[model samples]
Target: MGSRVEEVPNKQVILKDYSSGFQKESDLLVKSGSIKLKVPEESSNAVVLVKNLYLSCDPAMGVLMRGVPVPGFIYPYKPGSPIYGYGVAKVIDSRHPNFKKGDLVWGMTAWEEYTLIPKPESLIKIEHTDIPLSYYTGLLGMAGLTAYAGYFEVSSPKKGERVFVSAASEAVGQLVGQFAKLLGCYVVGSAGSKEKVDLLKNRLGFDEAFDYKEEPDLEVRIDVYFDNVGGKMLDAVLLNMRIRGRITACGMISQYNLQQPEGVHNLMNIILRQIRMGGFTADNYLHLYPKFLEKLLPHIRKGEIIYIEDVARGLENGPRALMGLFSGRNFGKQLVEVACE
Candidate 1:
């Protein structure tokens, strides 16, 4: 007789309920479940079982937790189920031909100790492992692609042009600022706290950085604007854009939690200034991954680009880390460290 597949206990972060207003840490509950170690023979489709290492706590996850149906390729997290997001994992068992045991990969995975990916095609195998594996959750993964596509593809920037970034301390925004600087543009960034602003100017190589909370009036006119925080910040950037300026809308973190999202009042400025505005999601530009790696790998190796992360250890702290994004409690990219190696 064949031996039975061993089932192991799995710790997971589960969504307790949907939130329309501000998301609280209590909304997520850490629960323990069990999973089989190997792919079941009776499985109808290709599946890969993986052990998660790190999980990314992005602002987009906040929108998903709200349980509101937004028009996108992604969907909202369901209550009573384990929440999932971008994470770095190691394949322990696989029925998919592309993946095998001991392969490191990153993509959408359940917020658990172990996950069974029914659609393993979404996962990307990790080709380069010389750098930190956790980087796959942010830099060299989702955020990197987003920043590269938004600035180079959507913004259509030119050398010596002035550039502005909102929420400049976050993962994507921080990178956008650095990219603008490398292109010889005069880069300015707006962050929530004085410490973050200092990090932007002193550490991240932005030409200038300001505490947006301190200076609500953003009067600087720029040729390119990277919009991360929408609502009032977007409205301000709209008014200050130079003629024929380009605005790349990457995210709207400010308006994600509100019951009624605040409206932008200065949209007419886009017409007046002949501004070209475009929004993008990284999934649309997956073909450019190799090209992005070619451009970014050198800067990373030479220390020209700096990526910071605020890591929350353990699965239990996942809720707190994810919620910190909305309050600006995290200094950099917020992520959860589920396991080591």
Candidate 2:
């Protein structure tokens, strides 16, 4: 007779209710539930069990918490259920052909400690382990992919071109500035804090970095603009874009929490200058993952690229860490480390 598997407690971060306007830590609740360690006998071969190790906190998650059907999101998080997002996890058991027990993966996962992924194919197997595993939540995962696709595929930057990026110290923006510099473009970045501005110039190698809050004039002509914070910043960039310049609209962290999203006043510049502005999500360019890895892995290994992360320990702190993204309180990529493994 086969031995019975023991049931274990699964700690989870649950959404208490749909958020309106800005989000507070009270919106999320930490709860505990029980799950059997073994998959059901009748389950399909595709089922995979994973122990969640790290979870990424992103601005887009704020939009999802509004109870609206966000673009590229399958559905809104149900009230009283665990919220899900990109995370790094280790497989505890698997019936899938592509994965087995002990494999590390990064992809979509629930906030719970243990998750039964019915569609295991959605996860990406981690092949490179030399870098920190937490990087899967940022540099080696969605944010990195977004930056690569936006800058390379969307912008099509040329050497010596003038490039500008907003919210430059954030996860994706930091990488965008570094990528532009590596490509031989003259890069300038704007951040909300002086510390972040310093990091952009000193650590990330940006040619110039400015504190947007302190700058009186934001209009500065550039050949390429990577827009991470939308609203006024995007409007200012539009006014400054050179003729035939490119703008990659990767995200709008500034507009996510507003009741009425701020409107851009200088879109007419696009027409006058014959500029190209395109909005994209990482999912659209996922087919280029192999190409991105090929280009980025070497940079990471050689220490040419630097990644900064603000880690919150344990599942209990997940709510506060996520809230920090909205307030620009986090220094860099925000993450919750649920477990050591």
Candidate 3:
């Protein structure tokens, strides 16, 4: 038997109830909880107890809070329980052989100071420590994989092709635009705010970026479209796609909070333009994680790729940070710092 460790006070962000329409910060509540420092011996399955350092605030998390059935890969957040999402953590105790005390990992974890992961195999052990550990929450984690697979595999992009990315300043979109530029594509991105537009053009190396609010129409013809925000933006892009254009539908953030999702009138353009459209979830492409790292790590090391993050300082601010994703209030990848390493 392992030595006993005392219970500790744990702060948690709990889901208050099922939500509809726009998600508000009040939908999540900060509560005080408690947990033992060691994995329980009575557990039937392998588990790892972790000290969470960072929690990701993603647009998809809002979908999980709607009090509806979710995909098996990501279960819905239960009301009165701590909400779970992608995070970076340090293992405190483990019944799983793959992890041990002090091991760093990134995967789905609760919005609490401490979390007990029943399925330890889902966690990816952090190998390279050279990059900032917080990066795993977004740029080096799910967002990175989503962009890599969607653009390279699904879209099958080529050099000198024209590419357009919607919601181009968010976690996945920013990386998609950068990846397109790295491949010698002419990239144009649409962002909600002037700040995000400037971020895409000046820092992230996009050929051009425009504020969607200021310019409602997207007139440029493109060979590839990475659709992050669906609805009217997608309708506009459909009209501008060139012959044999490829469309990668990664997410429809614009429609997530709506009671009735907006319709895309130009889907017929897919047939007219001979566009190849593919929708994918990053969980499906996880097998390629090692390959993704091999391609991305070097660019990150050399500063060829730039990633931005807007961090909320405390667990108490987690709700607001998450809600920011829908309202375009977050300047970059929205994340919360639950505890500092």
lDDT of 3 by residue, 187-222 (tens): 999999898998998999999999999999779999
Per-candidate clashes, comma-separated = 0, 0, 0
What TM-score should be assigned to candidate 2?
0.97
Best by lDDT: 3
Worst 10 residues of 3 by lDDT: 66-75
Listed in order, each prediction's TM-score against the native is 0.97, 0.97, 0.97
Residue 206 accuracy (lDDT) in model 3: 92
**Candidate 3: stretches off by over 4 Å:** 1-4
